[model samples]
Target: MTERPTTTTNAGIPAPSDEFSQSVGPNGPLLLQDHYLIQKMAQFNRERVPERVVHAKGGGAYGVLQITEDVSQFTKAGLFQKGAETDLLLRFSTVAGELGSADSARDPRGFAIKLYTGQGNYDLVGNNTPIFFIRDPQKFSDFIHSQKRRADTHLRDNNMQWDFWTLSPESAHQVTFLMSDRGTPASWRHMNGYGSHTFLWYNADGAKFWVKYHFKTDQGIKNFTGAEADAMKSVDPDHHLRDLRTAIASGDHPAWTLQIQIMPFEDAAEYRFNPFDLTKVWPHGDYPPIDIGKLTLNRNPENYFAEIEQAAFDPANLVPGIGASPDKMLQGRLFSYPDTHRYRIGPNYLQLPVNRPKAPVHSYNKDGPMTYVNSGDPVYAPNSMGGPVADPELWKGESYAVAGEIIRSAYVLHPEDDDYGQPRTLWEKVLSDTDRAHLVANIVGHASAPEVTADMKVRVVEYWRNIAKDLGDHVAKGLAVNGS
Candidate 1:
């Protein structure tokens, strides 16, 4: 037989044996001289990176986004240029959970995407739902805390969640959705995605249009009831993730059709709802979705750690022609996302292969931890040496006039800011009779918990009364029937 080559340590030092570790007197204390054993153990100890504080439990896929229809009149972004095509990565996650949390939990599903466009990487950090619970960024930490387990008790408290919701009436709309069937999506592939915050777009003529993105799943919307979701928790903890992977592996590639609703900049003054409110949504009937492209997830990452785990996306990653809106929540996220990535990954995270922009990136930033690239000429701007120069003429982007005083004040909540219009619309118009019945049942079930005092239940009923009198009456009746 031919001789086999022996394995070696990381330093290219040949190993004497492959099966046994170097020990003193055969099974005594481990010898420090065993460099291979030491290296392996040390590396194993440091294998894990920091997990994300939110959206820790996630599933990702490699894909391509192809523009099927052109909207170049509304935006000059290269991704929307005629017949544009780009590589993409999509991640679906639960908003509140540890890495090992159940995939079928009743929480908002994160629908984030990284589009490697020719100009740069564009990230759409969105959610499966069209709206969120709170409008102000300051309330975010407190809201998340309420959703998490109590610090002292280390137990999930229905009281904590309801207490927060009852105090913040802004949460009623999303709370209604969360307590409905939509909260527990059957699978990530079967749900929709929305760029919940309003954004801005500019054309070649510098005309601006407020925009919202919607990704309707080709698989269609399917969700689980409260009982079904609870049962799924016990049956298969990773049901959604496994279902997505298995479907893709079996040649059933999941896809979402990209659509966008555009509103004229002039209409902000006359809109019924605050266009930038994270707690509300623009009626699709007013500004309907225009088909733009299709996003198809056809490939799986070869290495999860190198690709998915290292992937970073930020709302601040906007190119020329694509811009942000005055949405306060969106503004906060522009700073927060990149800041979190720097802390979780490193200052040079953008240079990582998974996050690096496909287009040439030239900036004044340099010399950080894990420095991967070397600027050949100079890192400073306005240099005499041959370096990247700014092109003002090429800066074709949105330009809007601002005439308001710069003051710290809440957004001008429109006449329809009563927090009941959309929820009532959803109940009466969007949902079927069966869905309405399930929604009432779900709300009543949650409110009937022993921890929820009669006063809290009465408050909840009164709150729902603002949305719908019948809904409030039915919920109260259900609570009474359950002997609340």
Candidate 2:
């Protein structure tokens, strides 16, 4: 064999011993002067970083987004150009569970993507479902608190979850999807991913269009039944992660077709429902999907902690031609995502290899913990020395006038913007007979838990009843309560 490399400490100093603590005697108390032993123990103590507030458990892989069709008429974003192939990272996660929680639990999955382009990094942070429980950001923390363990008993409480869902009428659409078998996806590759928010896309000629992203899995939709998912919790809590790693390793790479629905910028003003509403979707009949590209994951990460765990995605990382819409939840995330990363990771989190953009960074931001970039000379702008300057007109997106009164309010309702309309459509027209049965059974199983009180069950019945008369009737009947 070739000569084996010598073991060393983190600072590259040769370690005196690899398997022993430096004690006064072999069996006596240890000495602080043993720098190697002290360093080893200290590094071990700090090995783990703080877990994320939400989406704590996740796995990701290296991928490429290949643009197969032209969408340049809709947007001038470099990554959207025809035949452009951009490297990307995709992280799949459970929304409410902790780092150690089982992956088979009934919960929404995070489908966050980070695209590395010549311009910069663009993060599309979204979920598996197109629609969400609530449209506004003000109730976000309250929603998470209800899903998390209770303070009183430090246990997950069904009562708290149902109480929040029943009280918030806006939750009907996502709750319907969650109660269906689609919630417990068989694996990350089998389910679809969506950039649920409507985003603004502007062309080089300054024409603006509204767009939504859908990543349809080529592996096909697959899910586990309620009983099957429960069994998976004990059989293999990390089933989803394992499946993805194994599949990629075996050369069975998973791919998704990227389709987008585009609407004329002016049409959103007169749409039947609030198009910006997170609880609703733009009807496929009105705006059919146009195939734009394909995303395929072929590489497993060599180091999970450095590549996946340290990866940070922020919705605010938009390219010049692609910009934010009036969606409230998306607007809220633009601020929250970067802020959380700063606190959880260091202030210089962007300097990490996974999050660092492939393009050169010439930011004025300087001096924080773990900052590796020197960025020497003329850090301040408008200086006598040569420095980077901003060009306001270069690849800029279109801007709209903002002239609204400063007041606290919900979205101004459109002609058909009732809370129950889309959910009612989903129950009546979308789900098949078997899917409907599973949805009903799942809701009844959760709502009829012993922790849930009779009064809450009455409200839960009323909540589902508002979505569909038959659904509420069945849930009420299952809970042995008279129809409210």
Candidate 3:
């Protein structure tokens, strides 16, 4: 009726003054005895969660993945069985951007999905493109650093980005893709996504296969020209996030067709190219994608912080039929995602409702900072107090054989490990004439930014030439740079 109430601290104790801190005297310093003031200051200092190191800026939504075809011959994951449907959440993001970065920038989009399945939670974390910049995990931190701001000037140096890519020759393919129109997708719903790393899928019959995922958009592939994207950056920085929400709210559910390209286990050892390389892609002509399911986003989160920001996806969240391969970056991600979640959220991040498994959780996991439940059962295994034991009979994953030296070294080089040919193919066959022109313009524009050095500009042309002489010459001409 008249007035609501006074503000309180996190502990909910009342009688507070936000205007001034608890001080001994009007002109003196603050007092530590006032727990409320201390709590307020402490909470203010920690109000912001540590943004994700990569994929820091993102938008998330609730969805469902439904099996559209029978793929039981490949794997026995209940989510992939015919006619099966599972609740899911997808978070789309821009890599290397801050939490306030523009959405329409020309960058690789983070496409991470988590499925709450009967067996457990399955995370298919990937990107919009089918290939990556580097194949090793140790270089991951360095690579991301190059794409980020510099220490001295506090600005994103294009010279730094190009230097990293040009030095790491394996980045040719992804760099070419980035400079193309596909990088600035029209909207989150209009672009396709891929699980770029090679994964393993084993069947009930004990046969294993290497698999790659393709989530083709149902809204049709649409992209913005460099000019259009640049103009939109000024107009709407959050266009993608807003479009996704509006479409879902108006009952226009955005969807994708989940496809898979599987290679036989025996063929992987003798394949023409390294099947597990993150920087390369298997030719679709060799192993075509087979449609398997549909993923549709029909719901929006009620609370962005609780549902979207707290959602975590880890490559280590493997199920019975599906597992990981020898992709080095992927191998590193299996450990890093969970560790970061623990640090950013808390030790009990999984206990949050947004991340909890739909299936019953029976573990000896007891109390932590935010643990919601503490069943009065035995807290440890190997006790006569009737604690649950590990069950291997439900869906035991098939066994895989391994033999290698214990020492650390690079993956054995295949005959086609060089980075030139595939990217050349992309320039010649995939990009149309208009697309090629736009690519040249885009490369020139980025290279001519005020921050790039004259030396790095020369290197940029040389890097483009490494992909193809004509493409490189065109970029050089567009930039009006001499052959020096």
Candidate 4:
């Protein structure tokens, strides 16, 4: 027979008895001197930290990213070398949902990855879609508030959602995607992931290239129809989460093929559109994708709260050869991600076991809440104790000179830059006849809500007309709008 291990307090003291409370008698009042009982209750009360402001509900697994092709010419990052393998943690989430919201909600999924490389932790935070609703970071909060519940009613209002989307012309492309059946992914394993923002990849020779990342699912793309997703809410609110956990436990691990689109550093200056715009995508014909590696999630986390919930992914966690670009959303996130982690998980969140880097951490950052690690003497830099020093050469990346009075303005448009151009291509050239039909139906269902004003409905029609005449006509016909 196997021996059962004894239960202990967090401080490692053997618990006297966990089944009962210390009391004067079986029916008497409980004693305050019951330290073990108080300890258990107090710890349980504080078990949950504040949920994420955006991606509150999520699930993740440990995995290995195996490089199958050589991309050393584009990036000197060690993770890109052929045959190189890096361990990673991937969290799949719905953008608008609360911690307890249904997993099958019609929303864009957050595909955030944290790779533990030799240099340090590299976080690739992105969405399933290749483009976002807005390009500028200044409008991000308003955009999220519109999707979230109303301030007064505390209930989601379709009017607020449409009002924001119709007013912001740049939101056309992402809105078209959200109203389609593709919005409700069937399962995390069946959808594709993208590093939507453009990044700078530099090599050993100081050569620079602009890059975008796409992770195509090996299991194939699958989505639930609008009606099906609605039914799933009543049938099983946790359907997507349950599916992923069950599949992995049954040895049916999921995988994605990593592909990259590389653009020469000089091409952005004359490109048809502002390449840094988060609302735009680089046409495949212009910069074809190069298959680079495979990412397979084979290990399930032993403790969901400790391993997955506590995991922090920051865009600012860049390594030597990889660096940020001028994309406004990406740039804002570089500060926002770490800031949120510090607020949500405390100042020393990085020191948590899950967020800790595989590589040795040597820096001057010290002393905060939950400080566990010790830095022996010379806590500050420029010390005679021979502490670590920053190397400018080790962090060589692309740099360009810009001269102008600092002022607020939109991106300097290239010849082909316009809000509706790419969305037009997406509606006409990309979506099939069936997809177009579903897209229109989904729009009518959401926009025809009683709360949505007639004026807002007319504006919604105008928004689609800019994308394509047929899309506008279909929406108008469905809503019974006779040019009013």
Best by TM-score: 2
Model 4: lDDT of residue 48: 97
Off by over 4 Å in 4: none
How would the candidate models be sorted by TM-score, starting from the highest?
Answer: 2, 4, 1, 3
Higher-ranked by TM-score: 1 or 2: 2
State the lDDT of candidate 3 residue by residue for 1-484, as single tens digits: 7998888778677847878878878988888888887887798898778888899888979999999898888888888999999999999999989989899998999999999999999999999999999989888999999999999999999889988998998899999999999989999999999999999888787678899999999999999999999888899989999999999999999999999999998988888888888989999999999998999999999988788888888899999898889888899999999999999999888888899999888888888887887655788878899878887754565567888778776655677777878899999999999989999999999999988888888888899899999999998898787894
Judged by lDDT, which candidate is best?
2
Model 2 over residues 158-192: C-alpha lDDT tens digits? 99999999888889999999999999999999999
Residue-by-residue lDDT tens digits, candidate 4, 272-382: 899999999999999999999999998888898998889999999888788899899999999999999999999999899999999998978888789998666788978
Q: In model 2, what lDDT does residue 27 have? A: 88
TM for every model, in the order presented, reads 0.94, 0.98, 0.93, 0.97
Residue 434 of model 4 has an lDDT of: 90
- Residue-level lDDT for 35 in candidate 4: 92
Please estimate how well model 4 matches the true structure, expressed as its whole-model Cα lDDT: 0.91
Root-mean-square deviation of each candidate, in angstroms?
2.4, 1.1, 2.6, 1.4
Cα deviation of 421 in candidate 1 (Å)? 1.0
